[model samples]
Target: MILVTGATGHLGRAVLDTLLQHTAAHQLAALVRDPAKATDLQARGVSLRVGSYTDPASLAAAMPGIDTVLLISGGGDDDGLQQHQNVIDAARQAGVRRVAYTSRALQDPGTLANELMVRHFQTEDYLKASGLGYILFRNILYMDTLPLFTGPTVLETGINLPGGEGQVSYALRSEMGEAIANVLLQDFTDSRIYHFTGAAAYSFHDVAAALALASGRPVVYHDVAPEVLAARMRERGVPEVAIGRTIGFMTDIKHGQESLVSSDLAAALGRQPTGLLEGIKQLYQL
Candidate 1:
């Protein structure tokens, strides 16, 4: 059976939902820290295995009898790499055959700016050295997060960032989930890596133009220095560490680490992925 960890999370839930359409619930198991959060999945007849990434014993219990395991990266906090290490060790001990991981899309994984991406890089290295067959999903920034960079009222505050002229191959989280499910449903046995990014790359200016067109309002793109962006985030009550991390991502983009576009996502979905303007409309309800 295929076991999906983080079954209650946004991406994990989407993957399970897509899997239900392609495979029976009997062939699947969901590992979640809180079984109560997985009631909907359990109702669909999927086996619920209580597990925590911090608890190796629980992860070991969850991995037995599973042929394929999707180890969704842990929370955005600093402890995520440690949690992933625990999961990896347990999966190996439990005799899981195939493992898949979600990693970030970056031109240089060694960049020190974004701690989140750094941890993903570290986890990828760990997974590679584990002697197990693995698949790496190098996912780009989510288009859904575009709405977050813009203020509550997108049209009013427009989009502000430290990204300058940098471009991002932003893909929708839903389509990414679909692509991952498609990968797992196939006869994928060998270790392979796929860049799960949008079919096209768009600059912040292009995103602003798309938003303006979608909202029928002039939404300008404001490019500021990293420190200015950090100050803005701080003024909005974002935590210091989070603000630093956000700035780090922008720094990575500014250094041209996020501009790569790939056809792998389209091939995985068997169709064209959503474009910037349409995705903006869907996200903003415009």
Candidate 2:
């Protein structure tokens, strides 16, 4: 059986959709914190199991007859690393043959952003310590986030952040989903790490150009220092903690390290991933 955790999330839902295309209904399971939130997926043939990465017993209970488990990362908590370890432990005890994980792109893996990748590293440590076969989906930021950047909010408020000309290895969540599904179904006897991004690399300037072309307006780009951006976010009523995290993300992206293209995702899916301009056209109907 193929079991997917965080099935209610955007990436998890896409994985479940991809899994359904390749496997039978009885062979699929989805872990959710609330079964009712998964009513639509449940009706579509996924076995719903209520569980959390923070709860080992819950993960074990959710792993019945499961040969593979996709551990989606958790967010917005202090103990996220411990939570991921809990899931890995339960998967080991449950005898799951292979486990697929969602990890952030650390680029060089030795920079300040490597701290951002701590959860993934700790999880990997636990999996290896347990002697379980595993696959890692190291995903970069998604370019589809362009809409939000060019959204009504940003449009009305104006674009303001760091990295004016900085390039980003932005990708579509759809492509990330495709890559993860491929890894889960493939015979990854040897553990593997797959970094993911769209076929093309895009920069904030490129995104601004796309938005202007799509919206038929002269959208302007505004770049600011990290502290300035944080202060502005606070003035705009963004919470202090969220402001710090947002600044950190911008700081990481400004290094332009995660902005490069990697064909690993193409190799994984056996096709080129979606491109920036094309995705914007499809999404915005330009």
**Candidate 2 overall lDDT versus native:** 0.77
| Predicted candidate 1 versus true structure: per-residue lDDT over 1-286, tens digit per residue | 8999999999999899999999999999999989999999999989999989988889888987998999998877668899998988888888888789999888987665776678888899999999888999999999988877766865887777898888999999999999999999998679999999998889889998998888788988888888888887888899998888788878887788888898999999999999998898899888
| TM-score of candidate 2 relative to the true fold | 0.92
**Residue 139 shift from truth in candidate 2, angstroms:** 0.8
Colliding residue pairs in candidate 2:
168-259, 169-259
Summed backbone clashes in each candidate are: 0, 2
Clashing pairs in 1: none
lDDT of 1 at 213: 88
TM-score of each: 0.97, 0.92
lDDT of each: 0.88, 0.77
Tell me the tens digit of each residue's lDDT in model 2 across 117-203: 566777777777778888888888776666654445554455677765667777788778877887787764788888897666667
lDDT of 1 at 158: 73
